[model samples]
Target: MYEYIHGKVIEYNYQINMKKTFQFSLCGQCYNVLVKLNSKAKKKKTTRSPSPSISIAASEDRINKNEMSSEEDNKSEFVLAYKLFVKTADGISLPAKWFQESISTVDKFLLSVYNKIHLMTKDNTIMPSYYFMIFKTQKETGASTQLVDEQDFIKFKSEYTKLAARKSNIGIYVTILQPSITS
Candidate 1:
């Protein structure tokens, strides 16, 4: 004899607590419905993607080892630039000459900094887009920065430029919590 237990996955009672049992014997439509429900449950059980912040831990270890290696070898400009960036971002405040030469793409550098600040931000209401400034050099001053949307990549760049300008001595510092237009 065929039987069908049409109920929620959680409420389903099984002989050995196995809720996925498709009733061993059932009609074609009932079997289809069970298969569909199984798919839905599978989707719900899947985990969400990891946030970018999780990368910080790994990057930190790589940075520390690189620093030790840099001290041992006088050469290695890449390590030197990365160290300068890490220091400046960590509030050590390096001179502008160090940043004049390229380290990484400005976008990548800014995104890393933005991610760091975003993770530290206390206010849940303020999105990453809201925190920004345009870093301008002495020559390229007076550039405008606008927050475009939720992700607001444009606004982030603008904010970076402004901070870079202000700290033209060391390097720009753009924080997610800081308000560009305080009124």
Candidate 2:
């Protein structure tokens, strides 16, 4: 016997010592109904037309062509942008701003950030190289990574993408690197 549950067919059978018969009683009534355990439905065998097989070299060529086309499409379609929240070491939050991938290098990004800070504080004595930025992950125990001018913005963009995927607030912490005194 078979039963349907949630649009799926399941076998229904209960046996005790290889015996299939079971007793059932209803309130003030006794009735008997016959059920066929074996169904008369038959499944039809499907026949499909034979398909021509391609040579291994032909298949490999097709795959390589597809991969090349996809690579070109990705290069043309790729656009990287960021909405950065800047905060100081003293916990003061600066206005958030948008940056495009066209900024290219971390040095350029730091310069732009320095310009923003300069506009607010009106301090021109400090250079962009004096301040370095740290990106902290979205988790409470997440480690902070420092961004350096030698690296490209793609690294920062990738880190941002990872945190953004978690749907949490992301910000960059900026701190001044004090000059070390020597004897």
Candidate 3:
């Protein structure tokens, strides 16, 4: 069986063996599913692996704490670093590095980026509600994905840090949606 979500297709497999079960992979991680064949079927005990994003969030918290402490030692405030780009008619603009302090929510971070874009381009038509943001895993590959508003930002940063094999700033792409005309 296959499941589609957010432009990604997930493949699920059923194993016919002594223990009947299903397995699937999502977001580069694998998971096992237990099926109850009949009403009388006894529930099987199974252990689930921690979600990749959850684990990444935990690690990111630790990393953030360490970063703050080290920056304090240097008598400088710690800031979350990001590279921002706006997608326009021509193409994505050159990345601009933004260092933000004490932003915990995605909405607030996006608002800051929106304000920065407005200031830089002096575009009055750009509305905060009309634009959405995404994180690009690689600049050359253009592998971008939308993140949930909850804890996904931390997870994304953690993944980027791991991919770069060091502490690195995140790259955010902002795309503005045009208002629809109704006749």
Candidate 4:
């Protein structure tokens, strides 16, 4: 998965999409550990598919964040971006050398499922902007929960909360924070 994201980072870099970003192979052995997690989720049937509206909204939000399209007063002062492109247009690919076979299996499953995920949070706007391109996965409850990059979402949450602190009405603002994916 990391390798795939690394490829995305490269693409964005080459396309001049992301200007301030860096890539590194952190904890090569950890990829296997993460992949193993996917198998466990599969066995437990913990996969979910996000609503189509949510998927589109998330992708658009990512584009906006990357472009910093919000008004200065409406934008969050803190934002982070991550890349996740695994395959080349011509089918060339890189092997993920982080985990063992078990983990590799999980990584493969997630790579097949999760595809690309981008997260963003903005403030001072009418609603808080949250978006993701979640993959389909079954949830432990025999229900599908859109599989998403928990880490990237976490970063968005942290930054969003900080921006939210300045708002007067949390509940009212919270409602605005959610993306109108359906529209």
Candidate achieving the largest TM-score: 3
Q: Candidate 4 — what's its lDDT? A: 0.34
If both were scored by lDDT, which would come out higher, candidate 1 or candidate 4?
A: 1
Candidate 4 regions off by >4 Å? 1-4, 13-47, 50-53, 56-183
Residue 25 CA displacement from its true place in model 3, Å:
21
The model with the greater TM-score, 1 or 2, is 2
| Model 3 Cα lDDT, one tens digit per residue, 1-183 | 122121132223333342345564543112111121111123211434457567446644654576577445434323456667676534546456565555645666666777887775557667766667788643446556776554566566557557556654467777756532320
Q: What's the CA error at residue 57 for candidate 4, in Å? A: 4.8
CA displacement after TM-score superposition, residue 157 of candidate 1 (Å): 13
Ranking by TM-score: 3, 2, 1, 4
Q: Pick the candidate with the highest lDDT.
A: 3
lDDT of 2 by residue, 54-82 (tens): 33345446545765874454344233354
Candidate 3 lDDT trough over 10 residues, lowest sum = 31-40
Q: What is the per-residue lDDT of model 4 for residues 129-154, given as tens digits with 9 covering 90 to 100?
A: 24223311111133222334444334
lDDT of 3: 0.53
Segments of candidate 2 deviating more than 4 angstroms: 1-104, 138-142, 150-152, 178-183
Estimate the TM-score of every prediction. 0.23, 0.40, 0.44, 0.16
> What's model 4's lDDT at 100?
16
87: Cα error in model 2, Å: 7.2
Return the lDDT, model 4, position 130. 42
